[model samples]
Each structure stands twice: as C-alpha cells, then as structure tokens.
Target chain A: MNDRKTTQDWMKDWQALQRQYWTAWADATRGASGEAPDPATPWHEGLEQWARLFGDASKQSETAERLLATAKNYVALMQSMLAAATGKAAGDAAAPAWTEALRNGLNLPGLDAALHDNPLARMLRELRGPGAQAIDQLSASFAPFLARAREEGLAWLGAPALGYTREHQEHYQKMAAALLDYQDAVNRYNALVLKASRRSFEIFEDKLAERDEPGRRIETLRALYDLWVDAAEEAYAEVALSAEFRKVYGNVVNAQMRVRSQIQQEVERIGVDLGMPTRSELNSVHQRLHELRRTLRRRDDDALVELRRELERLRTEVEALRRRPAQAKPAAARSAARKAVKTGNARK
Target chain B: MGPIHIDPQRAVAELTTFNQKLAAGLKTLRSLDEVDYGATPREAIYREDKLVLYRFRGETSPTAKTPLLIVYALVNRPYMVDLQHDRSLVRNLLARGEDVYLIDWGYPDLSDRYLTLDDYINGYIRRCVEAVAKRCNVEKINLLGICQGGAFSLCYASIHPQTIRNLITMVTPVDFHTPDNMLSHWTRGMDVDLFVDTLGNVPADLMNWCYLTLKPVRLFQQKYVGLVDILDNKEEVENFLRMEKWIFDSPDQAGEAFRQFIKDFYQANKLVNGGLRIGESEVNLRNITMPVLNIFAEQDHLVPPSASRPLQQHIGTQDYTELAFKGGHIGIYVSGRAQREVPAAIHDWLAAR
Candidate 1:
C-alpha cells in the first residue's frame, strides 16, 4: 500500500500526501492567527482561507479513498463469484466456452491471468489508467505554479503589505482555496464512478444469477445476450436512481467547470497582455446577437399580428360592400360561421 | 459433468447459417450503393433557414380536413418516421387518407449554432404551423410530435393552443427528472456551457456515442450477434442498413439550443416543474387545453412511461387520450405492430376529434 507505482497503491499514497499537506498548511494558518503583525491589517485571512481549501482537499481525498476501497472490494467480490461459477466447469468445454465469451465481452488483455487473479480488477485497472495518467500530468503541470505561490504567500504573511490590500488578498486566497476544493471534488467524483461501475457490474451478475431458475433459465446464447442487456439496464437504473450518484455527479462536473474557468481566466489575462480577444468578448457578441435576434423575431411577430388584423379589417369592409351589392354574408358573420363549422366538425 | 446442457446439432446449424449469411451480407453490403428512403411523395411548400416544410400527397385524397404536421427531434433526422415505404409512419398516415405535413429541421451548421430553443419551438414550429394552416385553408392544423419534437410541440401548444387542433406526443418525456431517466441523470451535472463552447455545435459522433453507451453490450454487441440470422435476406439486410444509416445520421445540434436544452430541460427539469421559458413566454402546462393524444412505448429506455405519465396530471386538456405502444422508442415508429396500430390510432383519433 505504501508503494506509489501501481494504481491503487499510488492513489493511496496521493491521499496520504494530501493529508500531510493539509496538516502542514493548517499548522501554518494557526501559527499566523496566533500572532498579529499590526492589528490594522489582518495577515491570517489570506493564509487561513487557503488552509481551508487544503483541508477540503484532504477531506475529499479521504472520501475518494474510502469509495475506491469499496470499489476494489466489489471487484474482488465479482472476481470470486465469476471464479466460483467458472472454476467448477474449468476442465470441461463449458468453462472454455464461457471464458471465450467473457474474453470477447471484455475485449481486454490479461484475460487468462485475470481469470486466475481478478478479471474485474484488471479490467478496471486498464479502464481507469489513461484518465488517471492524464490527471496526473495536469497535476504535475500545476505543481510548480502552486509551489511558487505557496512560498510567496508564506513569506508575505511576515513581509510588507501581505500580498496586497485587504480585498485583493482575500480574493486571491479565496481563488487558491477554490482550486484545491475543485481538485478534491474531482477526486471524489472519480472515486464515486469507480465504486458505481463496480456496483453496476455486480448488480448485473446478481440478476443474471437470479435467472438460473428452472422455468426462466438462460437456455441459449441469445438468451444470455438478452440477459446481459436486461442486467445492464437494471444496474444503470439502480445507480441512476441513487441519491449519491446524483450528488457526486454534480459535484464533480461543477468542480471541473470551476477549475476550467480559472484556467480560462489566466488564459484571458495572458491574452489581454498580448492584445488578443478572449472568449468573454466573443460571448458578449453572441449575447448581443441573441438579444437582437429575439427583438427582430418579436418585431416580426408584431408585424404579422398587425397584418392579420389588417387582413381581417379589409375582409370586413369588402364583405360589407359585397353584402350591399349581393347576398354575400358580412365578414364578421362569415368568420363566425367558419369558426362554428370548424368547432362543430371537431366535436364530431 | 458440465453445469449446463447443450444441443450440439442446433448450435452447429445456427453457427453454419450465421457464417454463410455473414459472407453473403458482406457482398450485399458492397452492392448497396445507397439505401434511399422517404419513399412517400411530398413537396417542400415552405423553407426557412435550412428547415423545409413538406406537404405529403397520399394515394387516397382528403379524408381529414386538418393537415397533420410531424415535428421530429433535433437529436436525429426526421427520416426515421419515413424510413421506407413498408416501415414508414408518413406513408401509413398518408395511406389512411389524412393530409400530412412534416417539418424537416435540416442539418444545423456553424452559422446555425446561434439558433436557440426559442428559435426552434416558437419561431420555426409556429411559422410552420401557420403555413400548414394557410395551405390547407384551415384555422388550425393537427400536430404529431415525436420524442423531443413532442416536447417542443407541447411547448408550442402551450404558447398557442389555438393554432393546433390536436396535439400528439409520441414517446416524449414530459417529466425530465423521473427516477429511471438515464439521460437526465447523465446530463444533470454536465458542464454544458464548456461543452457547447468547445464544440460549437455538438458533434453527431459524440451524441451517438452517448446514446450507444447506455446499453453497450445490447446496442453494439448483442444486436450485431443477432444480425447473423437476417444477414442472408437481402431485403432484411437493406432494412437493417437503412436503420443503421438513420441511427448514425445524427445532425449536429445548434450550440445555443444545445446549451439551453441541457441546462433548462435536462439539468433544471423546468418543463415539468412549470418554470420553463422559451424566449419570453413561460411554458405553463395548463395552457395545453387542446385535445392531446399521448403515446408512449412500453419499454423505451430513453423516455420511460413514467416520464410521459405525469402529463395526465399536469395538462388542462380534459380531452386527453393515452395509448400504450408495445415496443421500444425506435420500434414504435417502424415495427410491424406500429405500422398497423400507430397510424390507424392517430387517424381514428384525429377523425373523432
């Protein structure tokens, strides 16, 4: 578990490191708060705010660890269940056929080894590896910038101005705090997904096992195929309906958006320095065009409404003239009759 | 001893047939230059910003006074309703001697990315209804909304109830946040703004991926495995290709509209909750006072019957009728049962109304 090379081991190490970071950060905050540089300006606000973010990150890391552990256990359970069923028929054709079917279903390597070890775990390991790798890359990229900021922040607490005026210092600290919070939310989301996916497959297996009764037994390959679909939908329905899924889903996405927004802000700041138009400017234009189009539509609607009214009025006048000359009905009377006929026909 | 029983002869027979058919199917696939559809004769009577409104002329003439307009969802092309002559809902409606019109919300592009839901429901649909009414010389036209189009039609009827004599919603989700709503669940937390901004118009490939992943083993794997049975039948192969084309022929969703749809409908669940607004007009379900024909597929994974069932409690229409279509979402439009039951039900309902 202490090793940081394998997926689970590395994730566990990351969580522990985050906890240590949070502890160190919190200690700094407490040290800052215990002393006052001048009383006129509170130096601890910036430090303490960032400290809370680190604390949130630590909490999220712990939560994700718990969920991931649950997921790992679930994977182990599925491996055991699958092994129990397949191991009985191992020496026969049925076992080999089932293995072939499973291998095809998984479409992943290490199948032979996975059968002996844990197929579900191997599958999950491969599934999560790429995403984990990408996240690690991004985290590494952000590390240097964060390290510099941390140094600047700690020194500024003891140095002149404490980074800036009260408002600016607070805003910067709050933003840093948010960055940590976002990362935590992402971790929580990732962990939740791992657990949810493992749970989903387990549910599928459970339902498939249930269909082993006499009358409802899966008799054919087609039946097994159908069972897979039924089981998947059933599993999806369960996870989809759960309150935890919804909460974590929202948390993860919102956090990702927040992190993206911060990155976009930095990009915009750099763009502004280079005299380039940012997304905000384009958005403003889009907003204006949207409003203008709506206005044009409203104008068109009004004109159409007015035209209809004018048409009706002209028809009324024409009908009046025709009535004076011949036995033609008045426009009002004719329109009324038409409506009556329409409603009457509908009623039929 | 083995855990299960097997019929070796039956298995061998099936496998042999499957292999032979699969070979024939490849040749048939190569021979198929194009699987053309929309067999029913129609003329584009109106065109607005890539959307063309076609008025269908059926074999039989003028049984129903009001023309029926089919409004299909933007998620996919409308040709699913008119897939082919035998499987076509449009043809079926036509054969029933009903005047029919269809609004083809054509493939949206970069220029159309600015088009919002307001532009779709209020602007495009409203104008199309008016055009159909004028063309038929009637005060109102009958509207049939399929899936998301049904949702749009609901919004339209709410806004201008007078323009639609009858409103039919097929496999439409009225309640967005239902417990079994997988689509809503997945989209509830999505960063729609970022997604839209990044993609401009949502890519069809991505949209297809999202849908296909819902039941990956079934949609992608099992279905292909089952395909072996019908692979030798050229007709069946053609039918399958036509459907496969339609399934993959998803148009890019307009960016602004996609943004609003995901945020307002999927994320907020505003339509069912009485706070949905397209442009400026609030979509109050109470305003849907016209006769409503609500049809839902029994086993639709996309829009569960529970999602459509809430419309019974919400609408102001006392003249509401519900039909339980015994199929999935796609099957309700093309299955043989649908060919017989659906259009007939619609024809009879419209005639009575």
Candidate 2:
C-alpha cells in the first residue's frame, strides 16, 4: 500500500512538469512579436483568433470543440495527479468537483461568449436569429458532461494500448510479407504453365511419327487433340482468374484457340490417309518439279536431269492410276505390288 | 498526224479493239517474272548498277515547261501507275504532253538492310532528280509523290526546294494524330525494335498480314465473295487479277530506314514540327516555297483527310490547293470513277500553272 502511494506521488510530479513544459512551448510558438502580454486576452482567446485567421469556419469550429475537450482532459489529468500525490481514493473526491473547478478557473462562461462571438457563430446567428442562442446554451451545458465522459473513456482504454501496438504491428508485417510471397509464387506458376503448355504441343508433334500403327496413330491423334483442348481450358482458367495477367494474356489464349481449331479441322480432313499420298499430293510433287524447272531454266545440269526423270515418273504413274478400273483394292495388296515393282525397276 | 475522219461507229469499234489489245499487251508484260535488282531488262533506258529510271515518251512533242516526276512508294512496284492503257496515270500524263519520269525503287536485298536515309535521299533520289533535270535541260521539275513516296518527296522537296517547282502529294500522311486512322494507332504501339531485330527486313508477308488484319472481315470474305459478280466479264476479271497482284506483291522495307521512319514520323510527329533530320540537314517546311497541290481521298482509311489537312497550314507556300476525291487510297489512281475526275483535275491544274 505504501509503495502504491509513492508511485502515485511520482506520477503527479511528472504530470505537473509535463503541463508546464507544454504551456511554455505553446506560448513561445504563438507569441506576439513586439506587443506587451495582456492579462485581458486569455490563451483560448488567442487560440480562437489564430483559428479564425489561419483556418476556415467549418474546420475552426471543429478545432474549437477539440480545444474545449483538451481543456477538460487537462483538468482530469490534474485531478488524477492530485489523487496520486495525496494517497486518496479517486472515488472519494467530490463528484463534479473537477468539472466545477474547470468551469470557474478557466473562465468558461467568458470563453463560451468568445466562441459565440467567433465568425462562424456570428454567421449562424445571422442565419438563425434566436435558434443560435438556444444552440449555444445547449452546447455550453453539454460540454462538461462530454469532458467527464472523455476522461472516463481514456482511463478505460489506457490498459490495452501498449499490448495492442506490438501485437498488431507484428501481425500486419507477417501478413504483408506472406501476401508478397504468394504473388511471386503465382507469377512463377503462370510462367511455368505457359512454358509447359507450349512444350506440350511440341511433344505431340514429335511423337506423331512414333505411332506408326493405324490404331496407335488414331489414339495418338485423339490424345493430341485432347491436349490442345485441355491446354486452352487451362490457359483460360489461369489467365481469367488472375487480375494482373488477364488483359495481357487474353489475346494469346484467343490466338491459341483459333490455331487449335484450324489444326483440328485440318487433321479431321486429312483423316486415315494422313500418312498416305493422294492425288493432290502427287500434284504437289509435280508442282515442285515445275517450280524447279522454272527456277533453274537451262542452268543446273544435274538438277535438270533429276527433275526430268521425276517428271517422266510422275506422268507414267498418273497415267497408270487413270487407266486402272474404278474397283476397290486391298491396301496390303497395293503395297505389295508397289514394293515388287520398285525392286524390279531398281534391278533393271 | 491530222485527225483522220472516220464513221463514228467504225471509230468506236476500232478504239475498243485498240484498248483490248493494249490491255492484253500490258497483261502479258505484267505476267512476266519481275526483273530483279541489277539484272538487265530485255529493253532499258536509264540504268545504274543499283537503280533504274524508266521514261515512256509521249505521242505529242513535250511542250509543258515543267517536267512531272512520279515518285512511287517503295512498298510496291511502280507498274501500278502504268497498270494498263485505260488506267495508266503515266500514259495520261504523257498524252497531256507532260514529260514524265518515274523513280523505280528496286527490290532491296539482304546486303541493303543497313541502307540509311542518307543513301536514299543523297544517292538514289538526288541522282534521279539530277537525271530528270539533265534530260530536260531544265532547272526545276514538278514532283508528284504517291503514298509513302509522297511523304519522302515532301521531305526531299523541303530539303531541296530549288529543284522542285511544284509539289503534289496524294493520300500522304503528314499529321499522324488522327483518331480514325486505325493503322497509325496500331503501328504507334508496336514494338518496332523487337520486330526489326528478329527480321532483318520486315518480311512483306508479315507486313501484308498486319495490313490485312486492319479490315480482316472485308479483305478475307467480302472481297472474294464480290468477285463472283464480276467473274463473267473478262475485262473485270483481268482488272481484278492485276489489282490483286499489285496488292500482294509487297517488297520488304529496308530495316534501318523503316525503324527511323516509324520512330521519327509516326511516334515523334517530327516531320510536321520541323524536327526531321536526313543526314546532316534538317527538313524545314518553311523552306518549301513552291506551289503545292495536296490531294487526299475522302474515304481513305489508311491516310485520312485529317492526316493530310495540316500540311496546307504548315508549309510556307503561298499557292496551295486541296482536292479531296470520293475514293479510297488505291482508288485515287485506278478506280474507273477517279480516272475521269482526278486525272482531268490534275491535268487542268498542271496546264493552268
């Protein structure tokens, strides 16, 4: 009990010293350059004047209200300091004692009159003749009640302030760092997805020849088709869900869909004969021959000779195909015939 | 020869036959493989190792004091100006007794990738102009530039005003800030450096793709579909093929020159601001004191009227006239409607001067 009393006394002396230092600082900053200090001009009066000159009406009224609240707080702080110094219970002090002292010692009635005389209040009075007086009276009456409430409010909140500061700061820092890390991870994932999507198509193209069997080729083609469709869906999901990537990457997805559609249609049209040569294929071969002839003209003797032989072979094959009856033949039988003819011609 | 009197009906038939034969001859010539740069043509007039200037003489003895020099854009072969007997701007000018000279910008090869503005302006253009002057034995020549070549000619005329007596620009963009021009906006945002670095010279195929994309729906669908209506007419079919050939036969632009053009003209808007520099000399619009004729198509999507309007105000020339025609960019040269109005207007304007 004695130790508690001693701690209270120390707090009282510290608060008094703090008040004196703040009052002196405010005076030095807000001093008149050459005029003598007038006892008639209270500190609040100077504060009101500065607020009127340097601040607008709406803001100045708010400042005035804030200043009144601070004055009430100062009175409560003094009471607490006194309680600490005297080793007296806070509740034992007279009810409304600090409020009454603050009202009388600070010249509250005169200050209230000064606040009404302010430009903003004057304008309100002109705007609403007798209503302004009623408002002023009501506000003056409520000021003490508000100050007491503020004092009690600060006492209630003071216990948790230090704990909240450390806990909230650390939690916020961790959350912020985690959010940044998540963003980096998402970016890397998007890049990998894009690269993997591109490589998937390349892999499909490379493995196309590995599936030489008809059934295997069909299965492989279907898989390739599914891969394209799956890639497009994945790109859409990744790009659409991401806020930063949606706009820039949307066109790439659209282009991929278009190219995929074209490939699908072309693959469907090519169908079972994807590996076999057709009439148009032979025409393309002939077209290449013609192109070579046009390009080389009389020059390139070896190329010309090779092109002439190819042209004669193409002509003979086309004639044979035309002469053949319009009857179905087995693909195996045709292949065997082609092999035998090729070997015989080579031997000859 | 004196005007030969003949029956009106007979004259019409003969003229029609003559036109058909002329068109056939032009078609045959156009079908032949295009002459490569530095390759000798079967027939030639003025030939340098790097460049060639073709002169087609007029039927009438040349009487106009000022010779007209047609500068075609490097994007295409200059044969669009001499497409056929009916649609040929060169033949029309020759018929009007104006001495004509065309600048043929031959196809640039891989070695020509580093060719700079100095090489074009000082070497090819200057030599061509000097040749025209030397051939005419005249101090000044009238310049008519078409499309991109129009812009080049404007810069050339501004830098060398004494050589050009009168300047005519058709469907040329000077102010690139027009909001309606989609091509300008698309190109303004392009990564030109990345594109140029990857491809030594911008491939004509890629350039063609970009142009086609501007109006994909129209170029890919409506154009070919509309051809069905004209397939019955042999004349129309031939004309269609000729135009198609011209449209697709794009030449690759020199890489460095294209880079500078896009940077200096489209993005910076330096040409109109008098901040354009070709080699050591600055191109000043104030230096262009010659009479100017600014022709633009009212319906041109590539080079809108706004792109060509600011030229009249910026140039120091006192005598300036603007002729806005109802057509697209290519229509200014080849459209049947423009053939009568545009060419006649140009002839009258040239004759009056």
What are the per-model C-alpha RMSD values against the true structure?
Answer: 18.7, 38.1
Q: Which portions of model 2 show Cα errors greater than 4 Å?
A: A1-348, B1-45
**lDDT accuracy of residue A120 in candidate 1:** 30
- lDDT of each residue in A1-348, candidate 2, tens digit only: 133456556456444444443344244333522232353333333334333333434422332333333333222323332322233332222323322222233234434453321212221122332322442354346457545645576343223324646654444333333333333443443454444334433443334334433444321211322333333334333333343333333333233223333333344446534775543344356446645543464366458679999999999998887776454346657988999999999999
CAPRI rating of model 2: incorrect
**What would the TM-scores of all predictions be?**
0.69, 0.47
TM-score, first chain, each model: 0.47, 0.18
Interface RMSD of each: 18.3, 46.9
- Where does candidate 1 chain A have its weakest 10-residue lDDT segment? A36-45
Best by lDDT: 1
Query: Tens-digit lDDT track for model 1 on A1-348?
Result: 121245555344434433433343334344433432232221223233322333434312332222233322222232222322332322133333443444344432334542332333333343332333454466557667656766676454334335347644554554455456666775665565445455545655565555445565544444544554565555545655577767776675556555555556667777998999887787677678868878998898899889999999999998888767544446668889999999999999
lDDT of 1: 0.68
lDDT of 2 by residue, B1-353 (tens): 10111122232233233223322332333343432221111123466544678766766766787888888887777788777667877777777777777877878765566666655774567668888888888888889988888888888998889899889998889987666666666556455665454355666765665566444324443354344335445566667667877777788888777878878888777878668898767888888899899999998877889999889888899999999999998888888877777767777888887
lDDT of 2: 0.56
